[model samples]
Target: MMIPLAPATIAAPFARYSHGVEVPAGWRLAVCSGQLGMASDGTVPESPREQADCCFANIAAILAEAQMTLTDIVRINAYVTDRAHMQGYMDSRDAHVGTPPPASTLMIVSGFTRPEFKVEIEVIAAAP
Candidate 1:
């Protein structure tokens, strides 16, 4: 199982995330690579919200395939090409993951491997 942590001495997280996460030893884990806004057929969406939706969907699909779910995720790393897209990222993410969310980091990047790519998300999850 994973436990999200945010101590009183630390600043509260800016969004739907925790400051740290704890996963006990011996639990099965999955570390996902950066997932872009590509559909299963390799099509990239133009809108940031659409892309964010696709990104989380892809992440969820990966976890599902491994017999896990979003609730099991411990850490999340999000990268976006522009600051303007952050709202969409946060909104989409909050829609997918539940309360006391995983420890997370969000970055604004200059660009991506593909110019059309607006966001990339990476995740680490532990089995219960």
Candidate 2:
């Protein structure tokens, strides 16, 4: 089982995610490496919106490989190349992963491994 936590003390999360997550004992946990927006063909999208879409799509595929779903995700760490892309990032995230969201943190960085890569997302999931 997973318990999503958001203390009343801190400001509410900017979006759908919780501030923290607690996974109970006896369940298996899956920790995913950071995923970029690269597609199977080694193509990266041009716009932040497109990249965010592909990034989450990639995450879904990886979790499915481990027999998990988005609802099973307990935590996420997201990074965007520029602060200007924040809205697009959140929009894409909302379109992909909605209710029963994970505990998460989103950051803006100077750049990524590739200049065209605008977004990266990493997740932790738990299942019985």
**Which residue runs does candidate 2 get wrong by more than 4 Å?**
none
TM-score of each: 0.93, 0.90
lDDT of 2: 0.83
Best by TM-score: 1
State the lDDT of candidate 1 residue by residue for 8-123, as single tens digits.
99788887898998888889998988999989988998988789889888989999988988888888999999999999989888888766688899999998998999999999
Top-lDDT candidate index: 1
